[model samples]
Target: MNKPPQNSAEMPDYLKARRLHLNGIITLMGDMKKLNARANKNAKVERLTIDAIAAELDLIDLQLKRKCG
Candidate 1:
């Protein structure tokens, strides 16, 4: 059988997955930003969620920078 994913649980493109992931995070952040600007937005929860997603994106960036050799 083919080798299973080593870097992520669902994504198999180890080398380029970060770009994909960052794009997704960026999209999510944009949506959250919009929500935060709305009248009914929960400020505290939005702040926490955005912070968590940002941290996860940073980790993905760090992983992408690691040498494969």
Candidate 2:
């Protein structure tokens, strides 16, 4: 039988996952800012897109808090 891999004390699995999640959120926020900059062209559509992204970020925040805390 093969032994399962182990996580080191320096960096646990959850922490690693949290880091990835934070990075993704950072990217999403950056994209949202970019969209906001050009939002004047299509205010209605871009507003919806920004709202969706904000909702997603909120969900991710809740998940990270539950999982990481």
* Candidate of highest lDDT: 1
Model 1 residue 43 CA deviation (Å) reads 1.4
Model 2 gets an lDDT of: 0.59
lDDT of 2 by residue, 1-69 (tens): 333235444334544555466567668766776777855667676557657756765665675566557
The CA lDDT of each predicted structure is 0.63, 0.59
Q: Which stretches of candidate 2 lie over 4 Å from their true place?
A: 1-41
Candidate 1 lDDT over residue span 1-69, tens digit each = 345366453543553565576568768877867766766556777568767867877776676556432
Superposition error at 42 for model 1 (Å):
0.6
Stretches of model 1 off by over 4 angstroms after superposition: 1-4, 7-22, 25-29, 32-41, 67-69
Instruction: Return model 1's CA RMSD, one decimal.
Output: 5.5
**lDDT of candidate 2 at residue 46, scale 0 to 100:** 50
Per-structure clash totals for the candidates = 0, 0
- Write down the TM-score for model 2: 0.45
Q: Alpha-carbon error at 12 in model 1, in Å?
A: 7.4
